[model samples]
Target: MASDIIIVGQGICGSLLSWSLLQKGISVKVYDIDADHSATAAASGIINPITGKRFVKSWMVDELFPAADKTYSEISQAIGVHFYEKLPIYKLLESVKEQNDLSARATETGYEQYFTNTDVQYLDKGKVKNEFGSFVINGGGKMDTQLFINSYRTFLKNKGILIEEPFTYEQALVSKSKVIFCNGYKAAQTGFFRDLTWQIVKGEYLLVRIKDFYADRIISGDTTISPTSEKDIYYAGATYQWHYETEAPTEQYKNEIIESLNKMLHVPFEVVYHGAGIRPSAKYRRPFIGFHPEYKHVGIFNGMGTKGISLSPYFAEHFAEHIVNGKELLPEVDVKNILIKS
Candidate 1:
């Protein structure tokens, strides 16, 4: 019933935070309402070092990428699952303007270390349309989020730390030294972050079976495709919608993604599965971290948005350190500095 830390969500954020806390010899009690369609489950977990349009380096690629790789690798070994893989992303450009903009931006940002204007003539001869595009092969890859969560959950359960049910918010107790909320989105309904703008977007993706286009690398364009190594099975997805009826997959999104895929590839494929989840994106797109102003013990580690895979590890360690050792939080990402005043 009591723990040094009570985490109310077993998604990537909560899972990683729990792991970090346990590593520091802290007792963590994690509560979750089983898995729902959320970014962690639906995420392709791609950690691109460069942004798509700007081709600029990610916010903290030099640091975050290495830390993420090391963390995932260590955790994967401990849990006996392949959780991380380094893959080069082949970005397909559709128009001359996009190509030009990419080139100019790369030059301006000195992103040539990753970006190059290569003759993708081989791809041009394929059935798909190609207006000629540049390639930016950066050091980034994907995380098997679902596998990681399930494996970690099992690990925690074996260690007698996981509670596989929804935590009742009414049970949460907030005191001067500690505060707890039920889950990430549930915090919104609790009115804790009423002043903070939450831009919850629903995203959907489909699994497809396609033969002969197998590659260890990840392909990103209008629609991204990740090869799963299962013959003729690949993860192709993802449509982002600002407004949606529910967090369930829709035929409208499936058709749109499939149509987009048809435009990029010449091969035939069969639709296998569809998944949808709502991402807890913030208005400013930075993660929401810190304790409540009025409630000193209440803290949050949510809002990594789509970058949860890359962001969670570093921030989790940072947060755990802050909690355990009285260390100073990072200036840019410290939650206390970013909290919206009520």
Candidate 2:
């Protein structure tokens, strides 16, 4: 089949980029192996603006958050499904050092937009362990990524642009147009882009039903408790394993998540689901964009890491424009390096 673009993998990146191109009236043929346990399927899709021990704002949160909201909302309307929400994240403080550090940032002039004074108190005292207190960031939320991706997949299938199967680089017949790899961790093993710094990691998460322990907003402490469309059901996770044996979920990590959940909650909960996937993290910790220097028609849109929710939508539009209009990419994210070659 002839197309303007050929996309591999229907993860978050491929879904968004293809949607962007379709919006511009461009043609796309997406190839996938129907990997039921892909990263995007297991992701909590939490778009947290505040992160780390210091609670610093994420890189390009101002830009990425808005773009994500706009893209997800618009596509949701098109797909007849609501996938994104604007809810605050209540970060449970662990120590006095963290409390002090947060206080400084909360008092700073530029921080008020995301953080507020009322967000600094012992907010969830009766609900969760808030001895040190919890701070809230207003401009953060979660996306039902699996639902969105699934819906988008159906949409593509309906349009006759989706191939629900594996695609090998050796067997690619339609190679005239650009072929962008959005294949997540598997992209590193493709043998073509092996020179790119791929620091993939395994992430495990659980979905549980906590009785009467409902907090409308997301809770981030020992782990993240993200609310779903259902009542009292939250997506809880995740454990980062740098060196791991298999991609499948383990009983040991499931126990670890339960332990962390116990640390945050006083009530009982039942584990409904346990799943694991790999993140395509880069050594430089930025997304990999632009075409391959050797194979100019072959490009990549991977390395979204743990921030795929916040990163993919914006970069999808950016990279889509770069292809459709010959525009330049964000210099820091563009993968052209003379310093190191492999």
- Cα-based TM-score, every candidate: 0.90, 0.95
Per-residue lDDT of candidate 2, residues 185-268 (tens digit):
987876456678889889999999987765578888898998988787899998899999988999999999999988988778
* Cα lDDT over the full model 2: 0.84
**lDDT comparing candidate 1 with the true structure:** 0.73
TM-score: model 1 vs. ground truth: 0.90
Error of 1 at 31 (Å): 1.0
Candidate 1 lDDT tens digits, 1-342: 244678778888888888888889988788777654446878877888777566677777677777788878888887888977888777777777767766676665556655554334234335344557536566778877677777888888888988877665445543322434425555555646545566777789888987777467777778888876367777887677888887789999999999988887877889988888778777777777766676566778887777788888888888888988988877656556666432
Best by TM-score: 2
Clashing pairs in 1: 179-297, 289-335
Model 2 stretches with alpha carbons more than 4 Å out: 1-3, 172-174, 338-342
